[model samples]
Target: MSTFEGHVYLDHHYPPVLWNIVRGGFDSVGLLPDGEKDFAISVSLASMLQNSSASRLEAELSLEQVRLATTPNSVSRLRGVFVFDDIESISRIWDSNKWGGHFIDEYLADVGVWAKKSTRVDAAWIDDIINNQGKLLPGWEAAAVKYWSGRPKSKDAPIWEVLVEGRFCIWSMHSKEAALKEISAIWPNSLGLLTHSMNCFGLGSLDGQCFAGITGNEAGISIDHYLRMIDSKEAEFIEQLARLPAESPKFFAGKPDLEKMCLPDLTGYSGRICAKDDTNLTALLNLLSQLKNETGS
Candidate 1:
């Protein structure tokens, strides 16, 4: 029921196939996740809680490629990555404001306007689309229907609404700041600069995981530093959840962690791999996946 407008980052590792996925077109509605219903619902709920009119509920996803090495001096090869959203700006807006319901209502008044701009239809047509009873309305009608129906009836609603409501979590952003701030707080003596690629933003929820990744970034730190910060953030999120009421849907199983979240790094092994063949992306990918699995990443 509450609005959490934070940035989310999604990290996908592999060969440079992200470009293929983007060119293939990332459709939100048709490709429902197999086991992430809760995350999908959280996003649907978050959409209703947005401060702005989002008539185009479909998500925009893109990918970026980065280099990975096992060590600082080792040669590095390409890995697919993306910076899905810069949540710092939006997070400030939703977190600072107390107008949860008030803002949503205000934005609803413009949902028609948003639809008009996106679909290039007039107010009359927009109304017709919303009021339409047919199985299919027209161009973009299905998207409009999903958006309109998903609007939160009150500040709170049942969790099952996600099934009937539509998938809106595709519009979330997982902020890198979640890690940055927590790391700073936990390890005040640790000095490092962390940044993201800011190239892509996407949302997905599978197996209790709901996240928006604004992909890209090498966490310019050692493996120990990266894991330490990740562990700290997990603790912080767990603590925050415990303080909240049990009935609140805002608290979900997925809290950004090493398994679901990835920070770009050059490991010592990767550095050695680079030495074998700087251009061998396959070798680089194999090692990266191996490291990820071994570390439970």
Candidate 2:
């Protein structure tokens, strides 16, 4: 699953009570989507995610709130939205050579460090939490964790090892220079995952009909541009969907329109691509430095 339809943020919490269902979501299923998961996102799609798009879906990007201090009640949270990933991109968390900054150096690699620090954990975890499980779903549907049922594998094995392993896809590890070059690019995977529990039915929206879930990660451009990109009155479909809980119903349902991925006032809106937080930020900072070539797609 190379796609996610929600918004994510690295949040340093003031209090769980302050955040817990501030949006009113059904966490009874225990699919608390926050932390480590967002880091697995790929740098390849970082720019595209930030760009404007014709197609869209709702997604929630997040990570667990880390407690930094007990005396003063200080905590550290991630500070960006990342929803795409590949092997190389996930590896950037540790290897600074590709990502420009050292994530492990800052984070200390304790979150998902199960036996070792590798993208395999992120990749496997994504499939488990997303593809294998699902978003805002009930408790029963959360499967895929059976792969590791046995604490220590009786015997190491590559179950699906023979699936043409050499067909490797090229990936980028979030280079500031390479990312800035593609700032003008547009996107098809438009989404706005929920940040608060406004709707009652699910952690998403009340009716679970909205496709885009906005939790304030990409600022408000994600939904504002989506609705304003087209004349709400002219496009009856978009107009109606906007009324619901930010869900682009029947939205990303169609294939991507590479040519039509534009909105109004290009210069004015693109500048609001949401700045990345410097402290413990996994993705951000696409400056106009000496541009580098994007490799591995």
Candidate 3:
């Protein structure tokens, strides 16, 4: 067995920089650029950075687990593999139901408000119709119809076969911008300044709303496996796909196989994008903080 020793963020947000690196595709061929691979993300999901002390505690425990399982020589060779590797921050109480309803409703309202403000539409009409309407009251299609018609005409305006798709796509474009802005506010020097594509493509809805997933790279290979792959020229990345066990519905909740690539939940061990420097990690952390403060989560 191989031993791994290195620093990893026990709690860190998967920011947009890594998102742009991995390919993403959508139902509409044009939604994502050519030759992109789709990765599913959880729309109702929210990421928050653990407190420094809490993060340190988890890191220490994880390191101890690595030390106990592998040999010293193996550990030495594998140290570099953990550097800047994406770490899985396990949630002690992983309950999606708690935030699912509120996040979906608030997200829709926020998107409606953004459309009205950005398009220079009648602010009162938007506020009166889209923003104020409860999730079930006016309904998503009703709101989308009002918002789409209310806004000024443009060739850029999107047309969707299903009204829900329109709500999802339109919200995804704008919400991603909002998310990037939030990240930029926290980390001014972030490399992922530009928004790229939507994650969680094929997955339909999340908690009665569209599943606009988070963007990040996948830990397809575990740290130990990554070390082995790097050491062996024969280890083809394609062959590694066979190592993944069959469908794990408990974690994925009926999401397709592609979602496994998008979210690193299946990879037993954790890693990080920046081990030595955590500036980029703070961008998502700060965004989570602001969100929790506002939402009371």
Displacement of the residue 255 alpha carbon in candidate 3, Å: 40
> Each prediction's Cα RMSD?
21.2, 20.8, 22.5
**Model 1, span 26-47: residue lDDT tens:** 2121123333211121222222
- What TM-score does model 2 achieve against the real structure? 0.20
Task: Quote the lDDT for 17 in model 2.
Answer: 12
Candidate 3 displacement at residue 205 in angstroms: 24
Put down candidate 3 lDDT per residue, 1-297, tens digits, no spaces: 112221111111233322221212112111222222122211211121111233432332333233224321121110111111111111211222332222232232111110100111211222323222121224433443443343422333222110111112232344445544554454344222121122122122111111222233443211110010121133452232223224322122222233222221212222333342344333433332332232101
In lDDT terms, which candidate is top? 3
| Residue 98, model 1, lDDT | 40
Provide TM-scores for the models.
0.18, 0.20, 0.20
In terms of lDDT, the poorest run of 10 residues in model 1 is 110-119
Residue-by-residue lDDT tens digits, candidate 2, 163-201: 010111112222212222232232222212211112222
Candidate 3 lDDT score at position 71:
21
The C-alpha lDDT values of all candidates are: 0.23, 0.22, 0.24
Q: Candidate 2: misplaced stretches above 4 Å?
A: 1-122, 132-297
